[model samples]
Target: MKFLKVGRVAIITRGRYAGKKCELGEGLKTNSETEVLTEELQVVIIQPQDNGNKSHPYPHALVAGIERYPSQITRRMSKAKQTKRSKVKPFIKVINYNHLMPTRYTLELEGLKSVITAETFKEVSQREEAKKTIKKTLEERYTSGKNRWFFTPLRF
Candidate 1:
């Protein structure tokens, strides 16, 4: 009923938006200066949609949160591949948050490996008590880590 595992970030190579997938190689709290060319993105598991419905179609992945990446980072990553860089840059570091929802972005996962299985995602949202425990645990985890940031719940 509790979630101990942390989320990971990756780039969206192919989707409806194709090359415009949010850049997640960097963690969720990357700064504009460190954002060579990417957006502030997070990955989380969500319910899968049924095939029969059309209107108000259910989302296969629920968007928890979303924010734009630093402009510099977005520009660099979106640049056309003309020359190979000397070295492949490592994933950027962003502040980690606990008990906080991840940013929601529209990403088609038709062919990509999701961070967590659908079953896992549903189970987490099903129980209120479990959700609270998981959030607290995650908050502890985030605080111990460096440059981690937790979100205060929104009033809306």
Candidate 2:
């Protein structure tokens, strides 16, 4: 099974939100009489706005209603396949793990406020700082051509 945890920040490497960032929301578990110990490992995520909005455009009700597995959230598909489904699919799309790049940052879950202490916040801050330093170094060393960046270039 893939290693995943709630609150981890990830970048959508494919789909409409390819360049956008997201955070793990919650995980789904399953229980059965046949195997009392076996569990289904699935996850749901929250795609935060790039502009850092106080409230996400997608309502909390919608987010809570959808049950997206990790496989659905991180799967990569070709442009042709994506176009085929675009017309009929729902506005909110699930991404795949292969398409998500987990960043060094993680958002604090409101439900876990009591569990996440000051020390956890310090660790998150340190990770954010490290990410900034890494980004700065990468920016200094790498230059992208007009159409060479990972995300598809938008045409006017």
Candidate 3:
């Protein structure tokens, strides 16, 4: 189980907002009461402080509708797993196929490409895409004799 540190909670009481997908901004404040269209409203459970108790009453109706889930308990169980991980030896090894062993020379080769293509190469922030490029480049270099593949260890 994974515990998410809740930053804020939202409880929407009426209209289309009366659904689980209501927008919740992070903070605690009494939002001004808008004129209710009707006394009957569909309450959407928006946000929870560790999953709010439905029995608890608040100005926000959304909080009152949130059914308690077993997630909080499940999250506690996973704590042991997380701690045990740091202590136990990792059976699965992370092999960087891009490098024989990511030593100084391999790292230097990667850095040199970044420096050379300082104009055309954009510094991409997405990690998955970056990794994909690196993996593709490695595969290409492993299969083909190409200088471009050599310089950019991360380029697909």
Model 3, CA-based lDDT: 0.23
* lDDT (tens digit, per residue) of candidate 2 on 1-156: 133345555554444445444444332221111112221111124322222223322222101101111111113887656434322111122333455566565543244322222232245574345334423322232232211121122232
Q: What TM-score do all the candidates reach, one by one?
A: 0.25, 0.30, 0.18
Model 2, residue 44: distance off in Å is 9.1
For every candidate in turn, the CA RMSD to the true structure comes to 17.2, 17.2, 24.2
lDDT of 1 by residue, 48-71 (tens): 222212432322222122222121
Better of 1 and 3 by TM-score: 1
What does the lDDT come to for candidate 1? Answer: 0.26
- lDDT (Cα, tens digit) per residue for candidate 3, span 9-125: 222334322321111111111222333332221111222222223332232211111121111123455776643422211000111111111111111113212211212223344
Top of the candidates by lDDT: 2
> Candidate 2: misplaced stretches above 4 Å?
1-3, 28-93, 112-156
Worst 10 residues of 2 by lDDT: 61-70
Error of 3 at 78 (Å): 45
Candidate structures ordered by TM-score, highest first: 2, 1, 3
Judge candidate 2 at residue 56 and give its lDDT: 26
- Candidate 1: residue 22 Cα off by (Å): 14
Worst ten in a row by lDDT for model 3: 88-97
